[model samples]
Target chain A: MDEFSFINSIKQHSYKQSSLIKGIGDDAAVIRQPTQDIVCAVDTLVEGVHFSRQTMEPWHIGYRALAANVSDLAAMGASPAFYLVSIVIPKTWSSGEINQIYVGMKQLATKFRMDLIGGDTVSGQELSVSITVIGYVERNKARYRSLAKEGDKVFVTGTLGDSQAGFHILTNPGYYTDEVYYKERHQQPLPRVDFASKTENISRIVFNDISDGIANEANEIAEASKVSLILYEKQLPIKDSYEQFPPKLQHKWKLFGGEDFELLGTVSNKDWNELQIIAKETNTPLKEIGYVDDSQSNIGQVFLHENKQTYRLQKKGYTHLK
Target chain B: MDEFSFINSIKQHSYKQSSLIKGIGDDAAVIRQPTQDIVCAVDTLVEGVHFSRQTMEPWHIGYRALAANVSDLAAMGASPAFYLVSIVIPKTWSSGEINQIYVGMKQLATKFRMDLIGGDTVSGQELSVSITVIGYVERNKARYRSLAKEGDKVFVTGTLGDSQAGFHILTNPGYYTDEVYYKERHQQPLPRVDFASKTENISRIVFNDISDGIANEANEIAEASKVSLILYEKQLPIKDSYEQFPPKLQHKWKLFGGEDFELLGTVSNKDWNELQIIAKETNTPLKEIGYVDDSQSNIGQVFLHENKQTYRLQKKGYTHLK
Candidate 1:
């Protein structure tokens, strides 16, 4: 697939967002002049660190890069306008494969009304894609990791550990051939960019896209904000089949295994009710898994069911170097 | 080096520009509301395609990625602000080596007040880096590739083939060991970001960053704007030492060797005197290489000698895929 051909195929069907004054094929893509504050985020995915070449498809890789960046915009309480994608391809990867990745990326871009703006392509030793997404939020509406205060309630969008479970199913498809729900959930995880935009009532919140598992990102938010996060053992949401795994590994995978691409956010107790109402209107479950506290002043320790029991969260969130 | 460590090292010396509201350690770097239009551009460098892995230093690699993107923003007549870098490193490269790369990036970022903001780190099969730089320009003053009108005089900043000549010396250090000027030119290229901002009387201009050599980018401007560009071959700024190479290889390298990262742009004939004045003030030479014309409707065919023996210019510029 020629680069232009792949890009053209993507432009064939897209959401017509007015924010992109110039999208793709220029020195830079121009956006509608920012009326309010603009928020931008960037993320990169490489072959081994982010995805296993043996198990992941090009389309999944492409879709995840776009979905992942969009999730950051969502977490910021911004609407995505356009994204710049820089892709480096290895000789081993066919242009057709790269085109499939673009197809996946375009699908997400269209759904999010995020135009694929300008980017660069260079020959590399392995397949790597980096994307910078630009979005906009009303002035002062952006949620940041530093915004969480003591007593803020923690909430999560969508099901966690599903992507990790999906990875297992993807690698060992025969293990769950009889269970279609298990396979589908693992293969196609949704990014809640649209849903999160509706939660405007959750004011003065802090959030992160749950890429490095829920518990790991929770620790980051806490540590970065200089507060402590406590997740109740029973309040944690888990799929029924999640219990079938070896208990330690299952918890480890859910807590640290990444690529979930969900959103973990905090809001005041007053706003938490509004968030629940918003989630209900969309027919999606919003789970309250934890809360922030000023007392401990450390991050990522879970409160256990046994009285006064606690578990130290590992610093083993996905490190790019590792 | 650990990704965070390298990022911190770079951040320590990075200058904070007045336009940058936030830099590093965030989902994205935030820019203070620009008082003018923001011009943005991105560029990538790969180990094999853009530079030789065996010859180029890690710091040089880092520098070029940032420099090339800065050149693009400069071509649009924008002032550099902060930049977001995306890097992929091979596992074989040592941490110290990667740290030096960040150090090199830090040097240039400090020089230009372009903070090294959020980026990605991943283990890839080879080294690759991509940078997106955002800058500010008054909306009406922004230069574009489509703004060149017939009779516009094409001007180039600095000498062109020096980088190509420098590359040859880099690959074969023993070939011209005594010539420090030639060797240094190849190892370090200065992006003309300063030129675009300071040059006056360049309104409604068309230009591009000459990363892919001037001849090739000249063709791109011609193609994009649907205008014919005529080169005054006698005015070609061939360096004296470059004459030592076989005339064919030397000319080929000058025409096709990439990574020059200079500015090739056009302005009205009336601005020629003003350009010369600015060039003298800045101690940088601006040469009149050619002009845009509707008569020929072909790019780069011109008289080779003062006597006017015209020859066809080949579009033998560097192409990544080719």
Candidate 2:
């Protein structure tokens, strides 16, 4: 269809929210936020960079793009409220494929209660999607990486390395035939927005989602908070299928692989019981695998402990990893 | 540089604002808006569709991308507050070019008192930039395209078609050897945010930015407000150089050439004097171009009166325009 008709169709299908005074179809979407503080994060996924059209369905691409933005909000301890999508379509795509992309975004947006407020559509040589998510948190309640304190325990929600494993399986199907679980994990990784809310009551906490793996996330917190992070390798929660992979591959995927979309955070020692209670209440799988140390205060570092041996985990991949 | 270092560098150089509680380093940027109503607009400019690296400088590409989004907020009578940039970088570009892009965006942001809150960086095959801008409009003060009144006087802020002419001159450089005004107009079109606020106090006004030329913009108001818009060809604003073009070319450029980045609106006839006062106070170039007629109520249409003959302006394109 024409650009005007495409925009009009999007406007008609927009989900309404109480805060959204005006949705699509205007020069800009108007929203009267209920809370004073709002958090915004944007993510752009290109066709060849993040996903290939040949391997990924249009629906999955849409879901994954918005999911990445949602995961950022979840990492900041915010509730999803509104979002905008800008998509560039190539001439090769069919209109039906475009519809499926929106359907995918709609499903995730509906689940998170985020209204699709505005978007831009353009014709280009390659496909790309950029989504910006706006969310709300109470005044002074939004979590930050610099909030991680000494004696705080590092915890994570959900299993790690599964997404990378799934991606690897998809890329090398001949080697790992019949690995539906891995493929699904790569395509349909869930954002932990609900889990983030459950931990709101606990104080002295810091969160960073595992979009770029724990090595990077933990280091970010360590550097920002001026503390060292000591993670126990054996304590990491991995899927049952993780044992089938080589030892190095498992460590590489769990520690440095990207796109897990799970929350990795540190909380005060006293708040650990409180976090556990909320975890039980929310039915979220929570695991404590590390602790914050302030011994080396001038600079921060992340140390990985495995079988009584400890080594510095640089932001870059490990020597063994590459 | 690596992605982590790139993000860290961006975080260090972020513009600080009181409302921005957290900036680029975190998962999301937190903002506490001044006004109750927030207006959001997103625009994406693709490599080949909206611009080309060969024709447009890196600075202008970045400036133009953000300007388009800023204009949307201006049309809604909102003050620009914050923006997030998500850009896809191709292997063909060097780090210096990307730096120039951000420098270009920073120039506009500084001029308008906007903060660079957050952004995403990714590697891709094609270069594209998607910018989402957030602005605040006072409660019930935001202008809408669907608010045109029957006895309203249609107004515009700046001259039109300069951008199209500039683009044409650039593409056909040998034809317009000494023309620099048109080229500057194309590359550095200003967002009329200040001009939009002047009409804020005038009640019952409808606005649409002249990004896609006056024809498309005025038609949007006509369709939204369900009123007939009658324009006189004699009242059309054109540059002194416009007389040099062929009659058909002049009409096409002014009406449908696109990317003018000016404000087009209809205000109550009673408030025309007050708008004139605002025009004098703000030193804005405001002009009365047309009138809104309620004769065509159920569905709206736009008509142009030229040489004592009236012809309807279709949204698609004019027969005479082609």
Per-model TM-score of chain A alone?
0.81, 0.86
lDDT of 1 by residue, B207-230 (tens): 577777766677767766677777
DockQ of each: 0.19, 0.21
lDDT of 2 by residue, B1-322 (tens): 3333422332324332334433332111234455455677788898888998766899998888888889988888888877778888888987678777877887787778776666777878788899998877766677778888888999888787889888878887665633798888888888888878767777667778887778888887887788889888789888887777678888899998889898898988789999888878877788899999989543578888887878788765754421
Reference-based TM-score of each model:
0.84, 0.87
lDDT of 1: 0.66
Model 2 TM-score on chain A: 0.86
The worst-scoring run of ten residues by lDDT in candidate 1 chain B lies at B21-30
RMSD of each: 10.7, 10.2
lDDT on C-alpha atoms for all candidate structures: 0.66, 0.77
**Across residues A1-322, which tens digit of lDDT does each residue of candidate 1 receive?**
3323433432313223333332332112333445666666678888787777666678878887788788777777777876677787777987667777877787777676655546666666777889988776766566667677888888777666767777777676555432555444544456676667776665577768777777667776776677777776567666777776567767766677666667787888888777788788877667888888887635434332223556555346322211
